[model samples]
Target: MTAPPATPTVAVRLVPGPGAERVRVLAERAGLRCGGDEIGPAATVTVIVAADADQALRAQRTRGPLLFVCDTVSPEGRRRALRAGAVVVGAAELTEAGLLEAVLRAAHPHPSIPYPELSGVLSTGTRPGGPPAACTPALTARQTQVLRLMAEGHANADIALLLGCSEHTVKNVIYELMTRLQARNRAHAVAHAVRHGLV
Candidate 1:
């Protein structure tokens, strides 16, 4: 007998909020395949999208993976979201593909990134149960812009076009950002940026 196709691992929950329906339509259009609670095994990751951060918080049940889609996230809101262990992105400029990519990362994290997947670098405790090592390297303005775009789920090429620069320049800036953040990869850099509220 042939094996059946596997169900998608993550269960996505789009919270009701301003522009949420639009975002949901994008996810659907992007063909973001996901499993739900009723599937074979319960989904390990839960991606929640909303225009308001509080909508996400109210919708969260446990410390599962949260994908906050909003226009702006306040410092205090960022702090609260970090405490809740969430990942965020700016919704105003989101595209279907951007949303898809972010969801995929939240669902199936890159091995290069630190565990407890979405936890920021400055969690109250360290990895496996503590905080990250002290790391506050200063970043250049270009690097900060790149980091913010990266956090918003923009790829190097996209960043380049959006910033009116060459893709090569974008890559170089990202390299500098990764080094400065002491991040292993792009996703890691974003996590650090989010946790530190640098972006």
Candidate 2:
């Protein structure tokens, strides 16, 4: 695997309490920009501070790969994290090196995190060259906005904020776009959009 094209900017969302300070200090010490609560449009990775499984799960609605520093994570939480493309790092095991490594792996997804249903059917490159617009799917303006924001690495909540709509609207738009693209999930939808230049 290759490293991310650029040094990723990490968004750290803290669970309010004594441990919050510790996370702040650790992130700063590790040279990670503490992009507080609000997820940035350009955020390449995310770190969510959680005291336990529930908190970790609730704090992880953001997009892209994420690292969860939690005291304890349940099996269900692990499954959800896997499906969401996130890693759960036990708080006790957290370290400067570990944090940095998580950030690195987040940028370049590790093979251990399986790409479900991809089946080696995927290819890379953002250059538009699928089918002509006339032969491809047509996207609504809202769908286009959601797809573009998702492509630029914004979460649903961030997309809602950027487009001045509710998260429900964003989800509906994504569902609609995914249906149109015949995609299995958000990543697949974005990939299909890029491949077909439907965005």
Residue 170 lDDT in model 2? Answer: 92
Question: 38 in model 2: Cα distance from truth in Å?
Answer: 6.6
lDDT (10s digit) by residue, model 1, range 1-199: 2222223565466655577677767766666544445433344445566645666777776545667776776545555566456665668878776676666655554312334333343343332311334545667789878876776667889999999999999998988889888888887787666555565
Which segments of candidate 2 are over 4 A away from where they belong?
1-18, 37-39, 109-199
Report residue 25 deviation for candidate 1 (angstroms): 1.0
TM-scores for every predicted model: 0.47, 0.46
Backbone clash pairs for candidate 2 read none
- Best candidate, TM-score-wise? 1
For candidate 2, give the lDDT of residue 22: 77
lDDT of 1 at 73: 63
For candidate 2, report its TM-score. Answer: 0.46
